[model samples]
Target: MTGTDTPEWPRCGHTDSGERCRGRTVAAYPACLAHLDGTERTAYLASLTPGADLDHRGTPFTQSLLDELLAPLREPGSGRVRVGEAAFDEVRFTGDAELEGIDFGGFCSFASAVFDGGLYVQDACVGGDLRLSAAQVAGDAWFDDTEVKADAWFFKARIEGALRFCVRRIGGSAMFKGMMCGDAYFSGARMAGVTSFSEAVVDGEAAFDGVHFEQGADFTKTRIAGRACFDGARFLVNSARFDGADIGGDMPFTGACFEAEASFEETAIGGDLSFSGAQLAAGVDFRRAVFRRTARIGPLICPGRVDLSGAVFEAAVTLEAAAREVRCRQTRWARTAALRLRYARVDLSDAVLEFPVTVVGRSRPFVSPEGGVMAEPGLTGSRVRVTSVKGVDAAYLVLADVDLTGCLFVGTVHLDQLRLEGRCLLASPPPGPRWIRRRTLAEEQHWRAIRYGGGWTPAPSGVETYGPGVLAPVYRQLRKALEDGRNEPGAADFYYGEMEMRRHDAAVSRGERTLLRLYWVLSGYGLRAVRALTWLVLAMTATVLAMMLWGLPQAAPDPVSAGTADGRRITLTTTKPEPVNPEGSYAKRLSSARLEKSMRVVANSVIFRASGQDLTTTGTYMEMTARLIEPALLALAVLAVRSRVKR
Candidate 1:
């Protein structure tokens, strides 16, 4: 009923638009201002004053009505709309609305309000919270240069036009939960309070460039249909999250800085992800983040960890980070991925590679893995190294120009298929009495010290270093890999390692171990030609000495007759002399003639030939043994030389 003719003392039910009215009736009038007659409405309008507390909940206003309602609030000097606590909940503005330059003194709410035209509230300062929860704007909405002392909420608000916001500072929490907008631009905003856009949907490009959040900023599950750019944005306080956000186009975080942890966990980007010129002081997580296109996530300074664990990339990606750590555990790549890093301990455990992937080190400005060059200012050239590749199928994995001095190859699959290019540094044995002469794995050294030195070098914490039995296969596989790569000379070291492991392994048969030990003692596991040749020389020397001392007789055996014929009466007896040891001092036994004879016998014995001169039993046995053992040592020397020089 109209307030001018109403007789009842009850409140007005709703406005002309059928929205239930919550505004109080004026004086004795039973209806609100909208329901009052022209005379009564004019009387009610006169009662309103500037900066007065306003509650127009569920009120529907046309453009003229909105203008009339806002006309009184204009500040006397500044002519800007100034108001105290205001509630516009469920209010509808039928046409374009301009509420810009408004100074709010206390709490203001426009929750569930509908704006058929652009809603402009630029340069507004709110003393208390400003809420626009579930508000719908058919046109653009602007909140640029706005300052809210208390919490500001736009949760579930749907803005049809560009949602432009540049908050000067937000004192309390800011929420954009489940809001849908187009062309979101929040650039150059400084937010002092924590902000969240969780589940917010942006239909067009969303740019947060140069926005600084002193507190946390969350974009969790905020799907952006167009490009998402956070270039130069700073998150200095709490962790900035983008976890589960699905970005349709390119997402650029170029020149951005996140002091706290920045997460992109499970985020699906349909285009490129670039983080060039950014510095993530705390860790940056890309765990399970799938990029349908290339991800250029480098040329950045990450003092903290960068994890790409379980992330999937559709195309080539190059990461050049000065990071503390980078983990690619179970990360899958459809194409190539190049990691040019410095001072980062990369772990690629269980990573799946459909194409080739490279982990390279760079201390200087060099071409990136994707064949592009990055800005090289202040490049430290701190070596980028791989610490572990456990459980990685290395068939398509490559290490180029990286420091692998501490890379652990335990539990790696298809390890023999790994491709090595450029100067891939590996650990070598420490300086010892004997030259190690070859590069080896650090794990091998660690395990060897434990097995042989009775716990000399400590194993990794909480895990036992593999014993010889386990290391033997690793060496064998690597040797095969190098050999398959046509690096036989390089394989020699691994071959030696394999033999050493086998000799120490209890899994090996005792006879094999014994033979291996003998081989090692005599020939350095058939890889040291000097050891084999030296043993060969010693055997020949012993043979010569034995022959000179006991094999030669004092005089040449002479024929003597002693038999007499007993039956035929015409037989002559004959006896043959045998060789005897020379009856003289040891010096006499080393006579030049005897030495010449013994040397000749020993030289021929090296060829497995018997000397024509008869020798004593001990000398004959010595010659036979020398022929067998010395020639074997000589063959070992030959094999060692071949192993060193083979193609």
Candidate 2:
């Protein structure tokens, strides 16, 4: 029954959009060219010519049949197959398909194509855009050494095996939006326009070694489940954005270069994120980025601002970028960290540092992860300067070899616990017109300008401003911190600042304020030995002049002779004439005898001893007055001197 009935062409089962095929069939085989087999498929392909347009939609092909179709198009001299526009939509490849060294003269569409085996288009040239939208590739998809003149779209394409683009260059953008792939290797691929992988998912490792992206590279919202390596990759002139990228493993861009901005805003890295030896010529922003493991963000050369504001680190991190400015504001570090920066102004305001964080200005370049030095020429400076530590928890903060002269520590918490090493400096107030004051805080100057108008510039709008009530404790804590390090002299400036703040504090009692003011005026709060000595010398000179002018008598007094009558057992008292003012203003009062007597009286008065000399009626009162005030000035001078020399 089967032989006579002849199977009836099997009713050509292919369908599209719920419509049965209207495809032509020939020679009792009753199938289209794509479905033909054996001698018949070969016979039809033998008639195909080079550079001819072909339509093979929904074709199901074996490797041999596919090769046969491209055979006639091969160029004779160099074996370069050149074809016109081709459509392989919904085509199913049964085995590995090699289209290497082929040139497509027009657009190439493999839309919704399925490759059961590897798809190789290596060394191929596509004159127009290459579209593989919604294609499914089970084995490796090779576009290596290929050149696409127009855009390359892999939208929603899935590759179970590796996707490679080794040495492939693209003229237009490479769009991989929502693509789901396995391991990807793009080593040495150069993309002329933007290369976007937005919302794509990578299940295995990604290696983009030495790739050059001429415009930009965007990985926004990409979900990478494996480690991504971009060692030596270059983003030439545009920004490289990794915003909202979720990296499951380590992402190392070692030796990579970003000529423009590189942003990782809100990115989450489950493993270490490294940029060892990377050169970021423009700014790099990592705001709100989270690192679950250790991050090695340094040994990179970043000349622009490197911002890590609002970033949260769950483990230790070492950052050694030579950035101009580094902002760690509101960054939360859960474990011990180190920042070895060069020529950067670090801002750690509101940083939640749970463990100790050591920051230092490195004199030498940082060592890269591979044990190489990250040295760059022409850096202006190699010091890490801390500009603002306001709102920082300074309990476990350590600073070494840093410039803090202009640093603002107004809102720092637990400041007394801060540890500073290697020449930390605080700024001093500028010289006053009539006097020189000790070092003071920057916030104090602002407050003084507001209150007393010393011409200090006002803080910018929304900038934090501090008053004496806020500054006094700051000075006290800083003073204590320096003192704990056995830097007594270093703490002197802070102590003076504390007293000045106290004198200006409205919260202090009026009497205490007056006393502090007096302390400041008299001897610079007992810190200035020169001021006290100056006062001491002036007081001594005035006392000697007054004693010579009116305090001493005209001549030496004589003791009474009556005491000799009872020389054997008599208790005798010496009696002198009543003291009176010298009456001669013409010339008689000026004498050598009076000068000698005045010297003795003044000397004795200074030491609280009696000067045995005959005096005028006004002289006795003057001697008592001189004894009281002169000694206090001398004592102040001595105290000032001792305060400076003490440990």
Candidate 3:
């Protein structure tokens, strides 16, 4: 075993079955790259110290060993070399070497090998598939400016240091399943085929900015502990899915275009999601993506659909200044936050927006932006529940078939300035009873009065006219009139009733009518006329009674004389005097006529004694005369008195 005696060291050839010698020199280490089996190679490499070197002091190495190590990479005709067999402390492949571009055929193992210096593969191409699964590098691993013409599989490979692929291009598919890297940069890399990183964990930031994917791209279940940016990257063919990928920092897809479908379903992004200028040709499905912080998709244009169903934003989901048609079906936005849709055209038909969806400020909870006009005919069947809805100034907004049943609006629901072109039913449909009944006479009158005065004019100062009780029906009729251009009798009837009612009201106000016209008409006028006539009759009767009393006898009878004798004798005398007519001519005429009409004379005699007049009457005669003149004179006196009183 002495050095001078040259103890028999292991030969460079197979010392046992399935082994080869692969080291810079003999006596350096027995477990070199070429002397072990696949399993042994991995185990040996894992046992090395970090930053360990492969070449120790060289001894007398056999010529055969040098030739095996220094042989040029075999041509395409020759089969590929299975390079790494035994584990080494470190495996260093340096110098200006040109490996075969297409010869490698089987699995290449470099698992857990630490390269202390840079492993440069600049401008070199690997024609056959390269497998570096579970390989770890301590120093800088340069795949920069390189091309893998075949499918490159690097599953579970761990690069402890910076891994740069600054301008590398992969012609075929690049699979990096469960790959862990410290800080990886694929700044301008182009993957002509599918590039997948399913479940790969990156401890540091991974930048794929400005990278182009000709086929599809997938990062499903990938955990990026640092920022993972696909900013300005283009996915030309199929989808770029990031479903279940956890991004610990800001994941920006700014200026990226998904030519096909793009998905971020169930992906948990810890920081902001800035897709500010991304263009999505196909559908962008973000169902169930949890944004732990702010999520911004502002200024993005998706020609196809964008589904954000079941996506949760912990902070604000700002879509300010975006022009895409956002489909947010059943999205849950958090409190004290906003889902700003400022200056964006949102098609939320059939969307289920959760409560407290703020549009502008944090306090004001709504979906429409402040000072922003919503495009009409947009949100036909959407259900949005918010504390308030404001700042809508769009004309012809069609909310016809929308179901906003759960919306609870507080404060004033102002439609004062809103120009509703069509029949816009509010979330709460108008109460039915108001519109069910036909217009009453009073209602008709009101409508007519208003129309005559110019419909719906503001009242004069200090006057406010309340709206009609049946506003729904009124509005409906107006809408029909405007739309159909047909005149109905109902309108005219209403106008008539309105005028009549107004006139009656005015009469009542002026104290001109004791009763309303309707009441007066219902009761017959006979009672009023009878009341007036009764008063006149009573007055005339009083005048007649007064005249009778004034003309009645005021003096007592002149005398009745009674003479009493010793033997009870009595005498009575009566004196009668003036003529009936005062006028002398009428008296003469009456006397002459009385004489001409002379009547009969009668004589009477009394046997009993007593008064002088009685004794005279026993031997006297009495004359009777007809006297129409006296009666006429009496009637004239009465008539004269009556005429004087009348005057």
Tens-digit lDDT track of model 1 for 250-303: 888877888889999999988776777676767889999998875676576677
Mind giving the per-residue lDDT tens digits that candidate 2 earns over 81-182? 888987776667888877878888987888778899988887888888888889999999988688888888899998988898774788898998899888
TM-score of every model versus the real structure? 0.87, 0.87, 0.45
- Evaluate all candidate structures by whole-model CA lDDT and list the values in order: 0.82, 0.79, 0.47
Candidate 1 error regions (>4 Å):
1-29, 365-382, 429-431, 434-443, 454-456, 551-581, 591-621
Q: Which one wins by lDDT: 1 or 2?
A: 1
**Which scores greater on TM-score, model 1 or model 3?**
1
Over 449-522, each residue of candidate 3 has an lDDT whose tens digit, in order, gives 45554332233343223333333333343334323323333233233223334444433454434443432232
Q: Runs in model 3 with CA error above 4 Å?
A: 1-118, 321-330, 342-355, 360-647
What's the true lDDT of residue 346 in model 2? 91
